[model samples]
Target chain A: MSEKIKFTIDGKECYAEPGQTILEAALDNGVYIPSLCYLKDVIPAGSCRICNVKVAGRFMTACTTPVAMGMEVENDIPELNELRVSIIEMLFVSGNHFCPACEKSGNCELQALAYKYTMMVPRYPYLFPEKKPDSGNKKLFIDRNRCILCKRCIRAVKDEQGRSLFAFKNRGNELAISLDHELAENISDELAEEAMEICPVGSILKKEKGFQQPIGHRKFDKQAIGSDIKSVIK
Target chain B: MSKPVVATTSLAGCFGCHMSLLDIDERILDLIELVEFNKSPIDDIKVFTKQCDIGLIEGGCCNSENVEVLRAFRKQCKILVSLGECAIMGGLPALRNGIPIKECIDEAYLNGPTVSENTEKILPNDDELPMLLDKVYPCHEVVKIDYYLPGCPPRADLIWNALIALVTGDEMELPYEVVKFD
Candidate 1:
């Protein structure tokens, strides 16, 4: 048993393990912190910055910040609320994300967060960047506009598959996530089932799986991604 | 004595769209022969008033500054092209939907543990700032878009085809691989 630390989240004092994040502690205690780029089992990459909370006196990402003793955390501060909204805005402009028409509408973290935050109207003009529609790979489509380049897919390629097919390209708002081969060779038709299982977003999915299961009909068991993504490693 | 002026501008985006343009690799020389870059991110040229044959606009209009740049390009160019998902669909940053603009700014500057006081700045002149569209929109919604090459950043072939179409004056056709979300 590791050392236990106590922290106050949303006015509730709870005990958490040493290495766990504030998000883990809160979720463990039945408190929900809305997150998009976070998936259990895989190492936490706080790129999306959606799971923000006020720690002690400052706002911090709940997913990346480790637990500390006697820390007073405010999970839903006005400022933290604002950050979540901004991060979502950034995600919206970076991709062609239309939820009502998307397959992942009901289950989409982006849409769920919008509903939670009450982002009823878009505060910015639609950019409509010139983008190429779904590329030839039918199993999944890469909408450059919708990708925040969280690198989770790139991380999935490296951590789960043991192959570095995806690379983070360029810098600033222009940065994009890309795969080396035209079609991800390692992600063969057989392995695609597993790839879809590992990918966190609509970026990589099975071609045959589209519009088959209404997002509402899908069952979310909610477990770690330990063996699922790494099935291709060997 | 006639080098067609081509302009490029980046708006509220990560600049990934311009990088995708470089994916052209060796064929860039052939492209330069047809048109010269007037206000590209690759070059230092920022301000442009001359009429450009093609205006390649990247990034979504997120801030007042971004909207000004967009309108400027639209006014000067003979053909306005939306270059990536950001320019076309408001990109990922448009996710700020439903959340208040004040709240969005709060998250970036104050609430997070990495707070920097400098992140706090007076909101731009509300009148100057382009009003937020009801939702993220494709390029055709805001301005008269002459050609649209869809992609997060459109693939190389689609981009090249767009250039070819502009120079040759052909109709813009949706490529086979392009997925239409609208």
Candidate 2:
């Protein structure tokens, strides 16, 4: 541990221990730092770049950057807001994000983030990549149309779990997640469930849970996971 | 200080399993009396030890490297636990089956605006990347797993209970809610 550093988020003066990322500190204090790629406990990849904030003058991913003494951070800058919106828009276009039919509707982090930012219509045109029908795995299926390729699933399997279940099979947006095997019988429904939990969007969702709860009845949007704490402001 | 040696690794996952490992708030410190954090990315780590009493793995295997790691842990640890969806099933990355691999690559690097000019030149470039399987698979397809704690990052309680069972030798019987596959 070292000396505390001071910064401001949403105009609140905040203190963080040395080496703590700005996102972690803000999160500890109940300040929301919007992120899809930066799951706690995992090595934060800062891939989504949605949590970028203006520190003094320039912008940076709050999840990756370490804190310094007396650093000024503007988390809600208009430019950062625009960047977040654009990133969300890109994510929407990149995949088949049909919220109406998907399972993760109410609890979808991407949907919640989108709503938080008030993005009703996608600014960018849909990628509309003609995708293969859901593999009908009998257990789970990956609707690539809804995927954002945050790579959280890949990193989890490879680095965190010591199993390289997934790799960036191709480069750039062409990078669809594939098993190492060239055959279809390699995955199980149990693993699919795990993928569904971390996926922030409707892309990788539970097959059974899909279309089961019609968005409105799903809980947790007004609470903190299983906790009884309610969002008084919401 | 007799801390139980602990090993945490990813299988075929999104690393959310490891995140779930730390999700027990700071109360995890209480368990430190009986558990020693050994080979993990979060703390002091040296050799990839084979004699871990408890092994925690995330992700599923889509490559040879994943296979090797899984074998190493199975050989060393007394108890091996599959942590997340990737390791449990193939995960979202396994979703590449629905489209042609070439179409996926073309749309991303060749046709998409975000494509870097350098991405096209690499050996085994987009064209040479492993072809997508007709369908995604799970880890059990590759190995005989000892225990399955299923959740994208299986609920924290499930993780904690599985660990406690390791000490007690009480075979964990997943509830219908936990194991019922869609």
Candidate 3:
């Protein structure tokens, strides 16, 4: 058995196994930390800084930072939430996220986060950067306009041989997620569904399936994102 | 005291947001009693005859005419509200933002697959036509926007609640179900 470390998040005592990161420990203990990129059981890329929390008066990403014994972590606070909201807004203005026309609108995590943060309007000017949709793959399509560069699909969507189906195509400013067309052709339906689920936004979508669930019945429609964890913590 | 005058307009939009306003249904009777319409399509008022307490703008500015109308609203109304995705973030109209204006005009008039009839390849150059902007701009970017209701067409209850809150000076209820971005 691994040694358990006790920590305090916003003054509430919590415990986690030795190898667990702060985010893993927090979620396990029913603490909901707003995150866009970090996914459970996957390697934390720390790309999206939405989960940045103050650890011992220093800001750090909870997903990449491991919990230490008696560590004082600030999870929920106005200062941190304000910063997170700004990050969400920055993601919004930088991309051409037309939520209304998107297939994954109701279930999108980025949109859910915007709702959670009450993002009435982004403070920054909309970049409206030109991007194109790639329908090259038989199973799914990639809408680059809606991608937040979270890298979730790239890190999590892999084949039996442990090969990533998605990858980064270009460098900074022009950086975009690209799919391996050869691998994509043979992707199983299950893996195709997994890719869609793994994507935080509507960027990756199964070709034929769209708006499957009716409005008001979709995920995040009735309940706000992280409500389950919030309930557990409460 | 007089009823709070309200004005509304649709600039570079599909008018879906106005349809959502009508989605308020029976409560619109209540709304009619609570507030008076001035320069809104609902009243078929062509121009602003009096100052309005609230102005609900339904789209972004895509042309010179839209800018003029938006500025007129700003001058006549005390509080301005961006009523949907378009007004808040340039919505679908803003999709042309990434593409160069010249290329867009060419695609629409000269080189597109469906433009076979335009053998003359003449772009609309009428003096009466409003000149298109280089890019679609969110209403807030052009003029000061007081509040934003973000939806393709904001939910009817959301619109009703916002109008009520504004008129009665009551706190607006932002329930999770009503605050969707889509």
Candidate 4:
């Protein structure tokens, strides 16, 4: 293997291979860099700013920034953590995230991050924007109200011709993922499930699959997000 | 000294929050020893007999009556807390927030799938009826909320911990397991 690029994050020594991003290296070193919109082996969207880390007085998305030799990065710090918490809070208020009625409540990564940060209430006012759900597709249901526009579905769920199933429909505040019905209608059940799983929020879901996992048994029910990376946190 | 008085109300909620408060289980007796219930459904008191130290409100303001009641609570209680999801952010009732009031009323009283009995197609214009607001409002939007405990029906342990901390003036212990929004 190529000589691992040695670096330090928050004073702790970390190593990275040539092309691995800061987030990948951090995770390999058992350092959890909390992020949304980052799926392993997929092209980085860096749409969600939760994974932003400070390096040399510059804040950049950790998922996109490649690790360098002797790089000093700040992943978890009071100022950065507070900023991260604020981003999470903005995501909560900007969208109509009514967790109680959601199918992906406990399993949701967004909700789990909020839990990790202990957001008692959003700092901003609730917008309560009306975004109706599209249940037109046979296997999938896209609830626009919950979509943070992370582009995970757009980047990951694709047809054999390399056509994306989901695409951005509008601009500015009206921006949303538009699922191509023609492509989506013929989606396999496995792909439908994959589409739902890739979405960080409850925006994309498989139809006819109601809350099958009872409370306390769902994915994030017991463990906080990123807990599996570093069991004993600093 | 007399026990710290606690008052509670359910505005636009399903009373599940109240049930969760009771879900404190045998600790209800312990809670009673720490504080006295006043102007609450648990005691069947319709009106506030006196001033209260803390007022736990479980739901958002959905109507004129809710606003008036919330204002009254603000006047009578020293500390007002938004107890659950509905109170904090309008919850399920607020789903109608995006739609027009006319459409909602028409759908409810006239055009709904279950609507049947109104042969005269009359809408209720009773003077005693509480007027519906344009949209369901979080409690803080109407009046100040000193504290917020967010959950569907906030976990029983969360309610318990918050109550004890409030009554004792100790720091509230917010464990990861209890502070869930689900």
Q: Pick the candidate with the highest lDDT.
A: 3
Model 1 spans > 4 angstroms off: A133-139, A158-161, A186-191, A197-200, A215-234, B1-182
* iRMSD for every model: 12.8, 13.4, 0.9, 0.9
Candidate 2 structure quality by residue, lDDT tens digits, B58-154: 8776655677677887777777777765665455655554566666667765766786684544333355345434344455556566776655556
Candidate 3 docks at the CAPRI level of high
Candidate 1 yields a Cα-based lDDT of 0.65
lDDT of 3 by residue, A1-234 (tens): 877899988998889899799999999999999999999999999999999999978999999999999899998999999999999999999999999888998899999999998788899998888898899988999999999999999899999999999999889999999999998898889999999999999999988989999898989888888988853444
Q: Give lDDT: candidate 3, residue A127.
A: 89
- DockQ metric, candidate 3: 0.82
> Model 1, B86-143: lDDT tens per residue?
6766657766654566777667665756765655454444675576544444445566
Distance (Å) between predicted and true CA of A55, model 2?
Answer: 0.8
True contacts kept of each: 0.05, 0.00, 0.82, 0.77
Q: DockQ, per-model, please?
A: 0.03, 0.01, 0.82, 0.83
Candidate 3 lDDT at B174 equals: 88
Off by over 4 Å in 3: A230-234
Put down candidate 1 lDDT per residue, A24-94, tens digits, no spaces. 87777667777777777667888888888887678788898998999888976687878778877766655
Off by over 4 Å in 4: A231-234
The TM-score between candidate 2 and the true structure equals: 0.50
Candidate rank order under lDDT: 3, 4, 2, 1
